[model samples]
Target chain A: MASFPVILFEGGDVPDSLAYRAGKLGAEAYPNVEFLDVAGPRILMAPISCLGAGFAPDFHGFIEYRATDQGCPLTQVMVDAVAAGGLCLSACTASLLACDPVQVFCATVLRLAPSIDAMMVELALAEAVGNAVIHGNLGLKSDLRHSLAGLVEFNGRIAEQLRDPTLAARRVQMTALPYGDNGVEIQVSDDGDGFDVEHELGKPLEVGAKSGRGLALIRKVSTHIEGGRGGRTLVMRFLPAG
Target chain B: MDIFTDSHSDGTRFTLKGVMSFRDRDAFSVILDAVNQRAGAKVTVDLTALEHVDSFGIGLFLLANEQAVGVGSSLHLLNPQGDVSRIFDLANLDAILSLKQTMPATGATARNSAPPRRIGIDYRHLGKAEDGSPCVGFSGRLVFAEHGHFQEIVENLIANGGPRVVLDLSELEFMDSAGLSMIMIAHEEAEAKQIALVLRNPKGAVAQLLSLSALEFMLEA
Candidate 1:
């Protein structure tokens, strides 16, 4: 069986809700940022506002309080991931990040969550990152993906958007944190005008529909899916097979 | 990336300038389209003006070469300078792709330019299936990035296929929702054109996506 240990590094009394949840999941919780003798593969639970926490060698991952907090910047996520001894990626230059960042993210996450299905995480992550880069950052619409002409326009628009330093510089950040005893939670946030989550998710899926399958596919593969930060951030939870 | 094309009676020579990366995917596909449309023609890509290329950009050249060969033509890469040359040397791409340091003599030609797009997936003309239908093998991850390329393939099949075209997806590792949408569009187009677009052997994540999307029926014989 897999295990996920938590270290609360906020340097204060542990929240009762967090403590109870951690206990119910059969995981040990260490309060405060002080050093401790935790067994193997522990994660740190820190406040989203917390910044520049000293590096702790024992922790392998970091999770911010309330998965719904989408204000976490890419640089901060990088700092948190690096400080926690895991992986985080931010693509500021859309041209540079035009390559498959999702591939790198998925590979690193497979290492972080070895118990979860790799392919499921891969497809789910691809959709999220794809949404971030195209819909979020570039502000491209799904209707532009229905036909060849639409695709041409979409590609042209992407090329045009990448040329703009302002839009190109927008970041797409992805971070993975340990969830429960044997699960992982990924937060993908983009710097763009967000969409209507309720309206989009409420729309029925059509087999012949060329667009709008991204969220559906994500909902199918992950254990749960929720939108945050005005639809700019998407959180996906994945649990290992029992 | 800026692709300056000089189309002649026999073939075309493309002058690639600036950086060739995933950002230049649509432009690269146009080059491939040029290569595919004109078979038995020598296709030369002038890299003299090209300064740099990412790994995915390097892959575009390789795929273009593959496309050229499929259509009974040869691809020549000319005059790679600076970092482009060094990187190609380091990757030993010269051994795999034909490299030339010299440009061919100028001839009467027409010039044109175009946009760009990228493809994470690859496809090839796989001759005919058991029923004597033309088969095309598609491999690798077919996601949103490959949408334009996927459209090109479907267009090519519609233009040249007989009564049926088999899209072999056995070697395909993965696909996203956008990929599924493209497949759906292709199926619809083939049906309208009276050509049966047969999807074959989608395993692993690709299979699961089709099943989950209620599109497994597309894989049926």
Candidate 2:
């Protein structure tokens, strides 16, 4: 079977701009991503800014382009190929701060998957970071935010916990990898005690419920989701327009 | 943070300078108190010189507006530039707070002075529609970064609102879910005020987003 993320060339010819940049950077492949497309992951390549070219819905892999192809409008075309899905051609990492995780995720997503809906990513990432920072690292509960007075207490407790040297230093680790043919997989892991994944995922989405909305929202938007490392980590897969 | 307050018979204009963060909470509370003191008056918070604001600072503005609303007073924020403007745009604060687009000229106003530069989102209050409803045109990308300005423009158009208002999104190239949420919020808010918020001419990705988000009911026929 082919590896999950393969790379293919448009009409079997790598764009000259991409090849030149890769050669200048001393890379035989794309700068920030690794691939094993052969009886391996699907691999595809497109021109430097040719976001419109060669993204056949059936192809599941990163479309190779130069790092210079930053803000091209690739969403409409990709969304049209929903069944075929979309792919992330790049990857990035950041030291996550409690207050800045969403922004970090947003900036990284914009760089890696410019065609994806960033707000959707922002909302999902925000929930993941909140789960990591408040529930995992700091050992706080969602019940606090459901009440007005509890929210104040929760904020105070968070501030106090962050003042502790060890707690302040804890960071969430996130990694983005290509999933299936045309989706991005985001793995977010926290340093705190993990929760029960089965229990969490099994809970039915409650209407007008405030405390457990994050997991539900993540489940709704992601193509697939699973927990690992005793529930300390979550892998969320997102396809275009989801 | 520094505040230079100028009080007049009709209203009070507070010029805020320096960065506003959690440390300025106490000082901001005082400004909120002053705003409450002037009931039924026009209050302007000039932010031209204000360089930055964190989420906490933004919360203070929301609180200040709440206080102003309690006393039947109106608060208008003016001329936010740089990072201050960017933060406001990210949060979509203009949906609730009144934002002034132009500064008052001291003496003369030119006939054909160029319009202010379009930053993250380009918007123009296109006076009135043929049907007499207030019309506004929005072009370019509508995403999280442009939410505040987008809401502000729509809010201003609906201020002295008639039976309905028209939003022209024909030239709008893109809109994310955040932009869609802003339209929903605008619709709800307008409905509460007994005004119909009409969206017209959403093309390209903007149209797809609206449809994908299941908000076709919001568009005007």
The candidate scoring highest on lDDT is 1
* iRMSD values, candidates in order: 15.4, 15.3
Residue clash pairs of candidate 1: B25-B117, B25-B118, B26-B116, B26-B117, B27-B115, B27-B116
The superposed Cα distance between candidate 2 and the true structure at residue A211, in angstroms, equals 0.5
Cα deviation in Å at residue B83, candidate 2? Answer: 3.8
Candidate 2 lDDT tens digits, A1-242 = 21223234444455565555434432233322224234322334443222221122333333323334433212222222222332333211111331132443354455456666665665566667657767887777766544333444665776687677566555455556555555577766776899986688889754434356567667766777789989888878777773
In the range A1-242, model 1's lDDT, one tens digit per residue, is 33444444455666666566556655555665444566645555553223121122344444444333333322445445444545555545353244454654575687778899988998999898888878998888888777666777777887898788778767777778778777888988888999877688888988778888889888888999999889998989999977
Displacement of the residue A223 alpha carbon in candidate 2, Å: 1.0
Instruction: Point out where model 1 deviates above 4 Å.
Output: A1-74, A81-86, B1-119
lDDT value for candidate 2? 0.57
Poorest 10 consecutive residues by lDDT, candidate 2 chain B: B107-116
TM-score of each: 0.60, 0.40
Docking quality (DockQ) of candidate 2 = 0.04
- Worst ten-residue run, lDDT, model 1 chain A? A48-57
Evaluate candidate 1 and give its CAPRI docking class based on DockQ. Answer: incorrect
